[model samples]
Target: MKNDSGAVAAVKARANIAEIVGRYVTLRPVGSRLVGPCPFHQETKGSFNVHPDKGFFHCFGCQASGDVIDFFCRINGLEFREGLERLAAEVGVDLGRARSDPRAAAKKRERDACLAMHELADRYFRHLLGRDEGRVAREYLERRGVSAEMIERFSLGVSPEGWQGLQTVLRGRGFDDDSAIIAGLLTQGKNGRTWDRFRGRLMFPIRDGGGRVIAFGGRVMGEGDPKYLNSAETPIYTKGQHLYGLYEARPVMAKTRRALLSEGYLDVITLHQFGYGEACGVLGTAMTHEQAKRLSGFAPRVDLVFDGDAPGRKAALRAAQMLLTLGGACRVVPLPDGEDVDSLLHAQGRDGFEACLERAEDGLNFCLRMVRESYAPREIVAWAGEFLGGLADEGLRALFIPRVASGLGLAEAELRRLLSRPAKRPAPGPRPGETAAPRQPAWELAPRDAQILSFVVRRPDYAAHLAGAGAGELLGNADARLFFARLAGLVSDEAEARLTEPETAFWAKAQMEPPVSDEDAAAFFEELCVFLHEARESDRRRSVMDAIRLAQQRGDSEEALRLLGELQALSGRGDE
Candidate 1:
């Protein structure tokens, strides 16, 4: 639909929650509910509980509970509208492809128009990449060992020498400054002049899992200074948390049960073209735990492919430490010195690369071997002693205890003594066992709301019992009201009941069918309800006091005054 009122609503109408959830995890029946391992947070035991009667899922372990749509949003990482279309398709609901509200409808049309302009900008850049105008850009990539297929696979494009090339194209398509600004295509200079964020560089459009053009990362073609430019973190693109080639590499990563994590866009593209389709790359920063977890989510084993140079090795080693702690096989694939993954893969070809991959060492073993090879015999013992202190459990320590002796060529007694070095805390740190208070259900309004919801849904009569209870009196947020109302109206057989779950934003958006942060919405609703309840009690006391004052002014007898005082106290204003 070009535009419409409650655009979210139309999508929700057709989205099927059950069908979508079914695609991922197997659902099994247990009492009136279906229980399965939660996807948002990983756990072997079934913490993810689905209640068919309530049409929502709750993870007791992580405090993650949400309706069906929210589950899809969190699991697939889709925007509100996209999630709706997916779920709607699953349920066979018809969304008439257009919005009815004129303002919203117009804005929708304008958004598409801006997106079309961006597409045209990409096309123009792509056209330049193949021509003499883009010779420098083409040469730069060629030097980096990126092939033709790699270029096309990543939709590599180029910005021309001129400043207004993209602006002109976008303007011609009827897009305004607001449009380009929103898409992260344009930035305003100090002098109020607007210019392209990415200029005269190779452009890589970073897509989400669904393949929507979310943002771009650009690499400089000629020697100008600042080499790589990425779309400043926008609403859609989050660099530290996502990999560049993930959209393309996910299926392969899943099938291969491994993710080849590198450090550049071209690195992944080159690897993919060479049939290492599982290869993905983090952006221009240290790989984050979020990125590592995302990689682990798709595949438990990730081969950290870095340039085999000192800098690359350091990065790979750091990644190993972080990822190993996160629980996965973090293998370090060290390419030849001075050669990045792209160059090595190119020179050796796919077969050679696959052979190198076979030699990939486990993170712990790689670290230990590298440490022993670089340090003296005494230094090795000292280092091992210090590092072993990092091991938390005996099982974890046992994993490396035996390996340490063999790697260092030491006796079992010597190695055990080395690994069992006296544990000491840094000046300002907790001794072991000093973890934060376990997360109990420190929840406030949400629990009240959940209870109220269960009751209200069970007895629609209770909604009337909670009439003057401001939006807060009911649930944790304003959206809870919307969620309840939506559930109240659904034709059980036709509607996606999975949406109404408390932890999901999908149902929150579906019921409200608009842009609203359920986080803020829930908090506001809770706070507001608390305020209203306090105010109501205060008002009751004030009314009693006012009556007592009137009785005193009337020169009522002592008994009358005493009676009035007691009544005022009973109203919670004062004691008799």
Candidate 2:
């Protein structure tokens, strides 16, 4: 969906294309026009070109080009309001009353409600944890060797053991149990009562890259069927959509170009304590293709580490499949039989942990080995073999096939047979109108438009030229002449003799490239007559001085000195 009308309207308001592109991209003068790479698509070539005289964009690589607002929206992934905000920032124009978008606005309001609920709950939990009654949860974590700094870094909180403790607090804050249930912070009981969803536990808040608290994960100190509890999904938070600790890990991963994916929140923290702060984990689900793609945007590679158990093996295999599908590098670390990522780090420290990483298998290879170990029958193994083979690209298959054969101790010919098999369905074709024509200047120029060209190229001198020449004959174009006269009149008489300011204070809304019409030409001529009068006055003063100087040199003292004093006053060179 494109806002074609908005683009057309903004384009019409602009006199030149450079002004349009300047909203999104910086432009530098090249020959007669400004040039910069198009922001419409990801291309480095200055194929997206603009002509200052014509307000439009032409992209050579992918023809999806438009005007200023379109450029802002497409580049920044913003809506009309957001684009207006950016334009306001650029030229300091305040966007007026916003038009109706009730549906989007409602969704934003709901998300804001969810956000506020999360904040209130987080603060309450933190307050509970810091109190004397939270001693049990605090000591339990301390006994487990979790440092105070680590607890604070994770925003660890405690939930009271009483069923109605948190529910009472929320209810007093004007939210009934139903409201808390809707916010995913509480669960209603079958006996017409409500209680805290998390009780007698330490809480860990899960957030996105923007650090907005989307959900919470709580761990119980005592034995239970499910040792950990989490907030249910709400409008702004989705469990499968967000990975735990990703918010904190993102910046580090972006800087390092590597991320470590672990099994639990504690594993993530332990790795950080052991000096791998770019470590993160999935919350109660197998890693999905969506999570893999998001992680890849920050880090070039992800170490898909899981527990050394059957369930962990399955999770690692799923992570590998997603990574292979998305085409990024993955390394798999197999911990000791009884150890998870957390224990391994705590027991071995950074040196021992890194040693394990160094020996880790490539994720795809680890998945292949796991598949070999879990063979159901020859039928199932063959299908697994085929699926694994299909994951490789042509180039990767060439490099990986020999390695896979050697790792499995199978013949290369046999592996080749599985790889050669093709799928029934094919990928989609290129998007329609995806190819952009090579960009050319959108506006045309004359070979003899040097005077118009000089206005932009030589602003100081040429502006002064316009100032000296008065109006109509000063600049070539009627529009330029009219604007220059108005701009020149802005300069005071004191500024005239020194060529300092063209006095264009009144030229604020004055379109430099005004519309050339009969009226404009007439106005130019009117300004020209007044400018010529001043030019003649200047000429007469110079002539009188020359005659006086010649006469003085020949002993005509009266005429020489009289002419010199008159010249100073007429030129505004003397103090008035």
Candidate 3:
């Protein structure tokens, strides 16, 4: 059934917040609100409070507060839509087979048609895997250490080279050729020809949280340039949004509150087969923001298991950025230079894999180390500042300040001064009957940055005033920088554009403030420009100091003195 606001309200109304929370945590009666140890973060005392009457939860330990739907989404690693569907199923409320709206209903019909095609195609692929031509695919899997039980559990299939293998099966099931193509099972070739998309390959069905097969990933059994192929974006499937083995892994992750992230489909299957049931992998695409958010919902933490090689380390860094950007907890499991999860498990067994995980570095520390390795010594602080600025928690950032400075070979006091500037506070919640609240940033934007963006968003031409003002450099907060950039992009076609979730709420808050008169705008803009100039000058002084330190390290007294002179002049305090 397609969901609507009414169906959501009905499901939430019927569902007991306490009962749902009780499933994951041990709660005790604490007056009106129930208290428990927060599942999202570690706590020695019960700081997680749930208000059943208000239908909301707030964790004092982590400051995490949300409604029932948020709880489901965070705990199960499901998207908003998937979470609603799950809660609806739990509460026994039907959202209707199609939404009440006609346009949505039409889209739902198309999605349903695609879903039916995938279901039929799954059977066809599985049936074909049992045939003579499928022997090679089966043998290849067997050699790769996949068991018959796992093969059945994962619903492994084979797509033969014969162009019409899948096409024939879909047509037999009364599914039209158009439906098959739309479902991503069949491809339209040059000259209006139709053929199977995955041919002579081992097929792995990618399922949603409900175990509904939505897409397929195929790996060639024989020689091919692209070793692995996945379904294109379809009416029902977005590759980056669905992970291989997620459906199987979610249950275990929910219980354990941890998940192992691997590089490929087989790595997830192998890990799960070897007693690591909480393992999942991204589809063929690079890790995405949606994937990171969804994974964070399934488990509070994810251990990224990549090949211990240059490319693997690089991939881990990219992944860490995404997770950290969203304030998701993660660890980077460093393998031997040539090893991956599957190969390591195959060679060293479960004990070896466990040892590797034990040595996993916290995602932040790993990211910091990566930055130190990649950037020049003089530029380390700037990069570190940028990375640390992405952190959502002010307390967490404070704790890391010393380490970041140490990593950059700077004093703690100097680093603290450099990073201690505060950002704007969160806007108040929406009033009754207002639109849904926007997603809040992990860290607030600086007030000046917020004001500048507010004005620029409403008056697009104002962005021109930021040129040569060091506006970008002065923005120490990542969220502010992102909002500023988004605001700039919105200048053209302002009517059709929609602000990002966080930006939407942020803009709403901005609109609530008294309007900026033309006189205030000019003065405010000039003040911001002055602040930007001073901020950029301070940054330059720090760069000079860094250069001086580097010069001294290399025993270059002359160069060190010259850089020190530059720093003194920039600071407007001549060397004493």
What's the C-alpha lDDT at position 556 in model 1? 71
Per-residue accuracy of model 3 over 232-278 as CA lDDT, tens digit each: 88988865677788888866875787889988989988998899999
Provide the TM-score for each candidate, comma-separated: 0.63, 0.58, 0.66
lDDT of 1 at 460: 43
Q: What is the lDDT of candidate 2?
A: 0.63
Per-residue CA lDDT of candidate 2, range 222-283, in tens?
A: 88747888778787665566678877776576456678998788888888777788988888
RMSD of 2: 19.8
Candidate 2, superposed: residue stretches over 4 Å from native: 1-99, 377-576
Lowest summed lDDT over 10 consecutive residues: which window, candidate 2? 497-506
Candidate achieving the largest lDDT: 3
For residue 117, give model 3's deviation from the true position in Å. Answer: 2.2
Give the Cα-based TM-score of candidate 2 against the true structure.
Answer: 0.58
